[model samples]
Target chain A: MKRNIRLLIEYDGGRYRGWQKQGKNADADTIQGRLEQVLSRMTGEDVQLIGSGRTDAGVHALGQVANFHTDCGMSCGEIRDYLTRYLPADIGILKVSDAGERFHSRLNAAEKTYCYRIAVPGVPHVFDRKYLWHFPEPLDMKKMEQAADFLTGRHDFKGFSSIKRTKKSTVRELYAIDIEKKEKEILISFTGNGFLHNMVRILTGTLVEIGCGRKQPEDVLTVLQTKDRQDAGMTAPPQGLFLVSVKY
Target chain B: MKRNIRLLIEYDGGRYRGWQKQGKNADADTIQGRLEQVLSRMTGEDVQLIGSGRTDAGVHALGQVANFHTDCGMSCGEIRDYLTRYLPADIGILKVSDAGERFHSRLNAAEKTYCYRIAVPGVPHVFDRKYLWHFPEPLDMKKMEQAADFLTGRHDFKGFSSIKRTKKSTVRELYAIDIEKKEKEILISFTGNGFLHNMVRILTGTLVEIGCGRKQPEDVLTVLQTKDRQDAGMTAPPQGLFLVSVKY
Candidate 1:
């Protein structure tokens, strides 16, 4: 009998080559490979877990959802304990639960949220260096917010997506886009039906360009209208992006 | 003409061996080394910087202070700009000032504060994994506080000192010891005139042991009375410790 198990995992993507399996040597070690290894050991069988989405190398996630099928009758606590003990220190299983038979981590998700963090002018804080992008120049929050407003709502985001994106459709419904300024950090959060490959990064890059006065807020609409990748801003670094939550 | 310059330095202690010079690869690459490198580049001469104290390898600092004598007539802003342009991304100089000849980073300090962070049960947070010690067990705050109280005031913490410590006189004034629990993290702060080699780590080890019910709160007294290194608890890992501030 197969039982569906849902897991909320958190990981530092720095050590791995993104979330998927890759070629030999350094690339073979990834979040998915590690998960399968742990599952294989726990059930004495080969288990392949499906994740909600793939994150680029050096990208982090706080509430990434994954699901797997197993015949074990152990409680959710037991599964969580097993993974915690066997998994490397960088990856963790935050929660475990029995999922519905037809539930899918990726297909069943209603919305997703991501956050990009930038540390303003100062010594890069020793404690937070790993989790934030340090920028020495003082950014204009009001300008960034104005650009953010232009990105909200449903639109074809082909201009912001990577060229490698193979998805059939480039359209995504952006529910909200918020730009918040903390003491020394600027947090840009996005909630949307889905994101194209590197869409958030490109969006952040364009907004940052706007904040720095290199581009105007109205340029965002122009870039969207152009639907050309070269017209979009540079892609932000992966370290600054975080998968905050996946809503089911 | 020599000018006394004060620097607020920040570093990620992981890559470096420690804050002091060591022999070969085992030695610390050091925050001091990096600072001297930048200074030497600015002025075509060797530069030596004196820090408030040494933080062992893997230990981080937010307000670590350093002072150097330089012949360059550059103002604080100029020096800051030069370092910001030349320094590596991981290390930064937050502030720079011309200090009086009598000012010293180490000797003029009124108090030094250090924070030791411990992550409670559950998954290791990817963002804070490098900066905290993950402890899976539930800790007793009351017991830990009781043990912490015994450490306050002036005492010869010979038992807590590492065997490698060369300081003949071990008597030091401990102004305060505070234990704070926030969410799933425990922060233990220590303020003192000076700390022995591995003093804070060993003290934290004993406190944690007490919190875990392995040792009584009064056991700290017995450990201090014996003045024997073997009588104390294990030294906590270095990553969990941070040089929080240095008051002048």
Candidate 2:
């Protein structure tokens, strides 16, 4: 008998190539590759670990969901413990549970929340550099918030994606864009049904440009209407972006 | 004309040896050594930096103060900018100010505050591992608080000092001990006029031991009375400690 297992995962992705397994480097340092290796070793069989989404190199995850089917006679607790013991310290299996037979990590996902951090204008935070984008210049929160207003709701985000050609639909529903200013940092969180290859980063870049006065808030409308990738702002670096959670 | 200067410094101490400049390795990868190197190059003369206190290897700092005398012609703002540009990313000069002629970093100091972070029993925070001590065992806050009470006020902390022999006075005034629990993490903060070598780490270790039930609250008084190093608990790892601030 096979069991469909779902896992809530957390990882510091500084060393990972990405979330997916690559063909050339079958043993490449990747989140999925590492998970598959640990699972295969524990179960004595090959395991295909499917993730909710692909996070780019240097992108961290807090509640990344993954699913796998295994015929091995091991309890969820045992498998969780084995993975915890063998996996690298940067990666952790936060929770493990039985999933529905038809459940798929990506397909069954309802929404995802991602947060990007910006260091405010002040002394550099050396310790937080690995996880934050340090912008020395003061950013206008009003302009950034105005730009964020234009980013909410359904839209064809082809201009924001990195992929040049794709068969999948470019339309995605952005439920909310919350911009918060902490003591010396700014956190921008986005909740959406799904994101394009680099949609969230591009959106952040656009907002940042507006905040810095290089681009106006109304420019977001033009980028969305054109559906041309070049029309969008530069993609923000991956380090500052974090997959906050995935709702099912 | 030579001018007295004070520097507010911050550093991520994971890579550096410590805050002091080693005699053998004059160009050591230490915080003080690095600052002197940058200052020497900028001023075209040798520089000596005296810190408020020495932090052990792997110990971090947010506001570790230092003072020096320089005959350089550069303005304070220019010197601050030069240090910011030349110093390694891990080290930063938060502020540079002209100090009183008699101002000494270690002598005219008023008080200092240090914070130690302990990860409680829960899911590991992978990103914070570099700055927090991960203790998976459950700790009793009440026991730790009771132990901290005995640590306040002036006492001869000979048992807490790592140095076997010292010419300096072991008696120091501890103004306050603030223990805060945030989620699954415990933050232990100490405000004092001065601390002996490894004093904060040893105090934290003693409190942690008491929290885990290995020692009792009254054990603190016994340790102080004995003035024996072995009477105290283990010296906690340096990474979990931070020199939060120094007041003059």
- Best-matching candidate per TM-score: 1
In model 2, pairs of residues that clash are none
- Compared with the true structure, what per-residue lDDT tens digits does model 1 show for residues A20-117? 76643443378888888888889887787899988888888889999999998789999899998888888888899999999999899889999999
Candidate 2 on B10-118: residue-level lDDT in tens? 9999998899988746665789999998898998888888899999989999999999998888898999889887888799888999998899999888899999999
Worst 10 residues of 2 chain A by lDDT: A20-29
Q: Pick the lDDT winner.
A: 2
| TM-score attained by chain A of model 1 | 0.95
Candidate 2, A212-239: lDDT as tens digits? 9889999999989999988888899898
Deviating ranges (above 4 Å) for candidate 2? A23-28, A71-82, A136-143, A213-219, B24-28, B43-45, B71-79, B213-219
The residue-by-residue lDDT of candidate 1 on B1-248, one tens digit each, is 68999998777787777777563344228777777877988977777888998999888887799998989978899999899777776676778999998789987887889989999777556677777888667789999988888889888898888855564788878899999988769999999988888899999998888898888899999878988888888899998898888989
Q: Where in model 1 is the C-alpha error above 4 Å?
A: A23-28, A121-123, A134-138, A163-167, B23-28, B135-138, B163-168
Candidate 1 lDDT for residue B242:
89
Question: What is the DockQ for all candidates, taken in turn?
Answer: 0.48, 0.47
lDDT of each: 0.85, 0.90
